[model samples]
Target: MYKLYVRPGACSKAINVLLRDLDQKVEVIDARNLEGFKSISPTGAVPAMIDEQGNVFVEGVAIILHLLEKHNSAMLPKELLKKTDFIRWLTFANATMHPAYSRLFFLNSVVKDEAEKANTMKAAAAKVSEYWQIVEDKLNKQRYMGGDQINIVDVWLAVYAGWNAYFPVEVTIGPKAKAMIADVQAMPSFKAATESEKF
Candidate 1:
């Protein structure tokens, strides 16, 4: 059996959405249980997955790649340039977009002053806006990240985009991205995994 560990409202939620879409069974550990999460995730990071053989997988990008490829899903893409673009956007989402909100939302933990925290989030908002526009441009050009069909990167983008409302940042998506998000959310599995979580 596969054991999935994720903090509520974390990127791991998207992984579970994909897991359900792939028709895989998983035992999810709640974020509220600190001991359970710490024991499984040595790094104390969310979204850790353990396979039946006890192999622990960390990081959303890695988990998505492993599951998507294992299922032989075209979400990964086969075309040479599209494959490269797929990896590029995946890394961009993880490295560039995700962390800005991490800092923006957690500013209170690091900064004591309310004014300072507000300023920090304000600064982070600009950075996030840049990343959002990059995605908007891409979506405007292609139906999905690499092509006309929904892929793993589309899942990543939609998940992050869904969380935009929770932060103070202003994220404006084009018609294409709006439609793409609708398509991803329309999936039964995606709705099942994400609709309940508070990001």
Candidate 2:
């Protein structure tokens, strides 16, 4: 069995969804309540895992790729080109899009001056919207980021979309992107993860 540590509503939610979707027997631990969490994940990040063999894994994308490949999940493409596309969109979501939202979170908590916070947060929100446009454009080509079927990237972006409620900024997600998120959220894995986290 796998042991997964997660913070409610964090990117860890994606990992939770992935574990369930893969039908992996996992024990979910809320990192917020766990003492000495940094000992497991030195960076104190959620979405960290301890595998059956007792090997520890940290970082969301790394853990996700490891599980998908290890389990030989159909969600991961077997073809060379399709696999490349999978990695591309995964990076776009984790590396590109996630940081854009991180900026908003940082500004909200760190900026003491209200006017400065608003200005910086506005800029960050614009950048987030820009990324959403890229997502919208991609979805215009297909039903989901992974083509006809939903993929982990879709789950990741849907989890990130939940953060919009935390900030006062208006991040404009397009209609297509919105629909995609809705679909991802409707999945049993996503619903189970959300409910487990009490979100």
Candidate 3:
């Protein structure tokens, strides 16, 4: 069995949803305690996992890809080029969109000066809009990032998109992004994972 360390509504939620969707047996370790997580991973982020073989893993993108590959799940496309695209989109979401929103929403906590907060928020919002527009363009052509089928890229993007419900970042994907996220939320896997959360 795999052991997942997570906090509710964080990126780790995607892994939790995937594990359930694939019907994989895994143990969840809620890392609400910052100290505990720091001891496990110096970066102190949630969604880290330990395989039954006692190998530790960190980062949401890496964890998602690892699980999909290890389990031989159909969550990813089989074609080499399409699979590369899937990984590209996943990394883009993680490295670009995710951090942009994080900066916008947590400006007070992350940035010290009140004068700099507004500027930071504005920059963050602009970056988020730019990244989301790419998603909008791709989604306009395909049902999912991996063409007609839902895959790991969709899961990663959905994990962040769900935050629009509560987080302060303004990601204007117009009506299409909203609809796409609604579609993802309606999936049995997404609903099950979200409903399981205490938040």
| Best candidate, TM-score | 2
Model 2 steric clash pairs: none
Give Cα-based local distance difference scores for all models.
0.77, 0.92, 0.77
TM-score: the better of candidates 2 and 3: 2
How well does model 1 score by local distance difference test?
Answer: 0.77
Writing each residue's lDDT as its tens digit, candidate 3 over 47-88 gives 798888899998888888888888888867689987888788
Write candidate 1's Cα lDDT for 68-181 as tens digits. Answer: 788887777778897787889889888888887677767646777878777887787778777777877887777877777776667777877777777654656667777888
Clashing pairs in 3: none
- Residue lDDT tens for model 2, 1-199: 8999988899999999999999988888889967899999998878899999999999887998899999999888899999998999999998999999999999999999999999999999999999999999999999999988998999999999999999988999999999999999999999988888873
lDDT assessment of candidate 2 = 0.92
Q: List the residue pairs that clash in candidate 1.
A: none
Please list the residue runs of candidate 1 whose C-alpha ends up more than 4 Å from where it truly belongs after superposition.
195-199
Q: What is the TM-score of each candidate against the true structure?
A: 0.86, 0.96, 0.87
Off by over 4 Å in 3: 110-116, 165-169
